[model samples]
Target: DAMVIQNPRYQVTQFGKPVTLSCSQTLNHNVMYWYQQKSSQAPKLLFHYYDKDFNNEADTPDNFQSRRPNTSFCFLDIRSPGLGDAAMYLCATSRDNGNTEAFFGQGTRLTVV
Candidate 1:
């Protein structure tokens, strides 16, 4: 399908270890977003890339960082992930922010061990 694809449907990392989740698409969308969702909580938008411009949510912790090397790809880097950071990380893309429906991947579930 010509939509978003996330690598490694699940991940397990040791406590305090760093982890990187990846997202890619064939849609050539210009905006890519990264979100975190925990049990019983709504998905939280961590940051997004509109082309080469980066926008991070104010509430997003410094532990979260993102990179978009091109229009079809983005990466989420969790530096020194803690047990509390275990959650589902999602990747989504749209032609433009709020201009069209966003396409999402199946999500990468992270577990801290």
Candidate 2:
């Protein structure tokens, strides 16, 4: 079974519409992260949850947010999708900080119309 998985590898939406992308891991890892990566750009950390500790990147936009109800699942919520929000949304998991390597899911490619 896949350790991490994202459904609907591609998603399309109209401008100003709300959308939710989900992530799940079977590794029992405590750290889960959501990153948005644009063309050729580094994956920018939107937010993460280390157990129940939520960490959001300073530059992340207000339109983006995340949720972690338990150790195995997390979700990214976009209140109002914009064209600029169209990018690859990656979900990752790690055991901890520098000691472990993070694993990523294929990602959901959001296309805002």
Candidate 3:
């Protein structure tokens, strides 16, 4: 019962190239989040989209973008990815904005060369 699914466990992209990672959830959670985790570092919140509302973290760069077409699907787009962008992109879903438990996908590892 995989509630959250992220496609293509691994990916590689050239510098300045664009790449898209996808996630889908079956739990129908109200909040969907995207996070970037570098090696041995904490996962940094990139953005979260819920109920048609999108929230981006202040420190997130312009190169990162996210789209939540519906409750079940979300996509993370990296435009002109730099070497610094290489990391694991994690997709998570929570029942609501409150202190509900969150379910995370296995994550898509992106390599920017």
Location of the lowest summed lDDT over 10 successive residues in candidate 2: 1-10
Give per-residue lDDT, candidate 3, residue 71. 93
Rank by lDDT (best first): 3, 2, 1
Regarding TM-score, does 1 or 2 come out ahead?
2
Best by lDDT: 3
Model 2: which residue pairs collide? none
Residue lDDT tens for model 3, 65-107: 9999899999999989999999999999999998899899999
Alpha carbon lDDT of each predicted model: 0.91, 0.94, 0.95
In model 1, what lDDT does residue 8 have?
87
**Which of 1 and 3 is the better model by TM-score?**
3
Question: What TM-score would each prediction reach against the true structure?
Answer: 0.96, 0.96, 0.98
Off by over 4 Å in 1: none
RMSD of 2: 0.8
RMSD in order of candidates: 1.0, 0.8, 0.6
How well does candidate 3 match the true structure in TM-score terms? Answer: 0.98
Error of 2 at 1 (Å): 2.7
Residue 11 shift from truth in candidate 1, angstroms: 0.4
